[model samples]
Target: AQTVTQSQPEMSVQEAETVTLSCTYDTSESDYYLFWYKQPPSRQMILVIRQEAYKQQNATENRFSVNFQKAAKSFSLKISDSQLGDAAMYFCAYRGFYGGSQGNLIFGKGTKLSVKP
Candidate 1:
């Protein structure tokens, strides 16, 4: 069984600053994918970033990036130059590359991020 954990239940970031959200996971599978999904007030889960277990390079998207430490099973998201629109509930997720639930995303409880002006 695989599980994702977000230690910080809530976070607040001032506008124009950077915020890093912590995440860790436990899994026996060697080949898998980690993801950071953002759900705003509208409740739409948007893909923030993704990292493949085999890839040494961390994944990045615009102001969003991930620090994926495969050996320690840590995957954290860093949001740079945070904005009010970036305020949302961020979830860390996992999916095995090949398995019965290959495409099914197993998510963490989530960390709610509040942006302050």
Candidate 2:
């Protein structure tokens, strides 16, 4: 079984600053995918970014990017130019690509991010 680990229970960043949330996982599968999901107060899960194990280059989307270290089994999310809207709970999720067509997400404990206005 794959397990996601979040070392930080909470994080905070000043508006316009950058913050990185740490995540690590254990998976015996050679192929898999990683995701950073953000859940705001509304409780809707939004995909922040995703990284495929085969992709050597880390994945990035606008203000969000991931530092994926396959050898170390570490995947962290970096939020740059943070904004008040970025305040939410961020979860690192793992899904096996070798599994069924529809894979289920195994989430970390989540890191609560606070953006100081």
Candidate 3:
């Protein structure tokens, strides 16, 4: 069984500043994928970034990057140059990549991020 956990229920970041959201997961499978998705007020799940369990390097997308520690089963998101539009409900998700997998995404409860000007 795999589960994602976001210890912080909410986070705040000043405009133009940076914030890091923590996420951890427990999975016995060696091959899998981790992702960060942002759902804004409009209720759209936007893909922030993703990391392959086999990849040693962390994944980055523009101002959003992830610190992926495979051995520790930790994947955290760092948002740089935070803007008002960055405010949203961020979720940490996990997916099994092996064969016969259901391809279901296990998501965390989510961390609500608010940007302050």
TM-score of 3: 0.96
Candidate 2 lDDT score at position 40? 100
Clashes by residue pair, model 3: none
lDDT for 70 (candidate 2): 99
Which portions of model 2 miss their true places by more than 4 Å?
none
Off by over 4 Å in 1: none
Per residue, candidate 1 scores C-alpha lDDT tens digits across 56-94 of 999999999999999999999999999999999999999
**Clashing residue pairs in candidate 1, if any?**
none
Clashes of 3: 0
Provide the lDDT at 6 for model 2.
100
Q: Which stretches of candidate 3 lie over 4 Å from their true place?
A: 99-102
Against the hidden reference, what TM-scores do the models get? 0.97, 0.96, 0.96
- Model 2 residue 99 lDDT score: 56
